[model samples]
Target: MTDYGHDLAFGSFLTPSAGTPEQTVSLAMLCEQVGLDLVTFQDHPYQPGFLDTWTLLSVVAARTERVAVSANVLNLPLRPPAVLARSAASLDLLSGGRVELGLGAGAFWDAIEAMGGQRLTPADAVQALAEAIEIIRRIWDTDTRGGVRVDGDFHRVHGAKRGPAPAHDIGIWLGAYKPRMLQLTGRVADGWLPSLGYLADGDLAAGNLRIDEAAAAAGRSPSAVRRLLNVSGSFTGSGTGPLQGPAARWVDDLTRWALEDGISTFILGTDDPDDLRRFAAEVAPAVRELVAAERTAPVPAAPVPPAPVPAAGPAPLVQSRHAGTGFAVVPTPDDGVRRSSRRVWDEAARPTGPAPDPARRYTRQELVGGQHLIDIHDHLRAELAQVQDLVEQVAAGSLGVGAARSHLNTMTMRQNNWTLGTYCESYCRVVTTHHTIEDQSMLPHLERADPRLAPVVDRLQQEHLVIHEVLEGVDRALVALVSTPTGMDELRAAMDLLTDTLLSHLSYEERELVEPLARLGMH
Candidate 1:
């Protein structure tokens, strides 16, 4: 029950059974107002009683602003990739990128067969699911020219381009239980969405063990694929769900299950309309309280991160930025060179950071399309080299007054012209993405693979916090300098303070991890 985004992942569903526009919107809105992490919708392909998931979600997307809209478990084999990609893209476009795809290979073979679709072998279904994902990603890459194309062993989808990607992160989740499907999930999904009871009978530990094993075989972190548990909205936890109980009690049980699974997201569904109401009114609050409480609590110090694995062959310098959400922190100049930066700040407050124009800042959706993730090796080498030189210079006491003044003058010039990308901007972009990948994706693996790395990782976490505060000070100074436009002295003072602190901090950090870096086969 280690703290692993339990607060962030606790989300539930609003089955489109009885939710009126007002009801669903009201519930979804209220959920976000209280910081409910996400909202999922159940997609029932053959169920006539339920509303079409696509139409219903578009309505929800228009109404809610912040909540992530996700598919509970979209059966992948049932839908063609081209069509599915288009539908998913449309939701992403409408929602501004708050859409997530929760897909499953589907257990309802008879259901599809009844609908006149072919009955799929389990192997075929999984293979089809794999091919579909490839095709869908391609469609996202290109425009809707000839639609989408999927020429695979199982299927060939041609043409299926959709416009306008999602505004925020559109994570893909795979619902898996068995080994093969779970393996596929590990290989292909942003998360492993499990179909399990919170406190089911007998030992479910076997599945957990296998999940970890399969994930390893795939050379992926079990954590790489987030764990999501789908459950009934009302939980009495007598092993029978929607058990008659007060909503608060049910929510508590749900949280308990989430913790057990090391999962934070719970996709809730119920037949009774009142169950949804009860969840929103009485239950959801208790869950959010726990979530908020957990978030505010101090994180346990993680061990030092293991050295990054060296790639055997030449890797792309930056894989399509579309490979993941948003941009990887580049070693590029952190100047406010991107015009959209300053424009954003001026509208809200005087330009504090380079990005003055808060009005035109790129959200995750817009940041997509050709940008790529900088390879971890390429990233570490440059940043480490930049930091190492400064650290050694400061350590040598040979960095005398002349050298200091020279460095300070150059920094001042960059600040004056607003053309210089300061350490502050570089640090912010680097940390925002760095923290996400390391703490969320990388740390877990390091902890398991090399216990030796624990202390180093702990120190890095401390560095992250210190750097964050330093950058905040940088932002404050930058804004003041811009508004008055004569604060070279102000700029000099800020840079001196930042540079001095950075030198001392990074020198110690470099010594601590330089060996690890070499061990990892990185420069």
Candidate 2:
């Protein structure tokens, strides 16, 4: 439950205020300049003080080069589905696929009717939205032989020509929270868009469930539907209020939502330029770093074996150790070399598993299984040292900033701001993956094969989570290294913590698991 396995994205949700239309566009540009991933505007055809969402999006798309532009929730009643589809596709083409569509069921019936739109009941509106979704999809299906055709109650598109595909696969995000709307979103939409301010207590979780269930029922993967949120808060003196705290609070709160609530896209709704800058410059990257760390955190339990064939019943139990066996008893290696300056855990306090029977011996499979753990640990040890070297090299002037940048440009780290950020993220992923394999496959199998190993297995599992936190600390330091003047000291300290935890955890795991694994083969 550490992560929803979705990529984290951040954006600005600026209000389309008619009074300051230029300011709204300027803020959208500012968001791109500050590293925000997206820029969205609200739509309300009946609101006199609001600018037209579509027009504003067009202007924004023209101005910004990288950030995506979207209507937070386009007023669907005022814009026909077919026309909306064409407009979205055209803008997406013009913007080089930097466009996402967020549509909403009609709201404010009185105002809808005043604007020459149909006044549909709540039930009718939901039905209308569903039909609209079908119509839009049909219009975008250029590969189909026939013209677009969807004979629906509300939105029937007959023989409409379908051409001019968007530059990329455009996602249709829905602003929906009610059960029926949530269900519709799961069944058809690419993303679920909701504002945190409008959600009541527990609504976020409940909505996710509804959407997931609907997606499953419709034969779609739940992860295929992206979770997006419209959030608002202020950076005041004290770290209080929902999101009304400093940048650190924003990072923590948003990261928790991604980890626990499965909401990956965070769109901050604010008109203030300073708030926008802070959210982008400070909060966004930190949230990404935290969520990414957690996503690869160790799994708590064993996963179902891949392509597991049905067994007749249960296999006969074998003795733990026998004197003469298939292969030589490979002893667990202990080089007695400690690389870390600080010890993270009390190794003396580690609980012991059942001792192997002296009479029984090990098999070739078991010997290989045990040595595999050591091999993995050795790899992690090497990677950790490299990570430390990278940080120190940058700090000590052995590697100049320009040389670091040049080296990074050849790697995936070039996408990130700082070299440390790229290196730390990659190293953390490797460590997390190693822990994940052991926790999910190795430890569970060992525990099941020998129940007496429970205490040691539990301790190792706990250490995995602790190491995850340490890795996150390193990530936070990496983020700071880009903006803070004296970030090297912080980075070094963070790396030291990681080195302590990781080295200690790896040693403890190898010591405990090697013998058990040698006695019982890994599944």
Per-model lDDT: 0.54, 0.77
Model 2: per-residue Cα lDDT over 1-523, one tens digit each: 4245677889988889899888888888999988899999888988999999899999999998999988889889999999988988999999999999899998988998999999898788999999998888777889888888888888888898986688888889999978889999999999999999999878888899899999999999898899999999988645556776666567657866887789989999988989988787667765665565454433222212223324665422121221133334233333445545666667668786665554554544447555655655665677688778777767766554554545455344323337567667767865765565567657888889888999999999988988888888888888777768767778888888887777766666665666677777766
What are the per-residue Cα lDDT tens digits for candidate 1 across 1-523?
5334534454567766643646665666665654556777777778776767767777777888877877777866567777777788877877777788888776677887787666778888889888877877776765445555567887786555554454544678887776787677767677777655533553235555666777788787777667777666343424344334544346546545554555666665543445554554445544544444434433323323233435676423222211132222222222222211111112122111111121222333222211111232234335534533433343343334454334434344334234222433444444334443444434444444556667656655555566556657666766655566544445445555555444344333333332222223221
Error of 2 at 150 (Å): 1.5
What does candidate 1 score on TM? 0.49
lDDT agreement of model 1 with the native: 0.54
lDDT of 1 at 197: 57
Q: Whose lDDT is greatest here?
A: 2
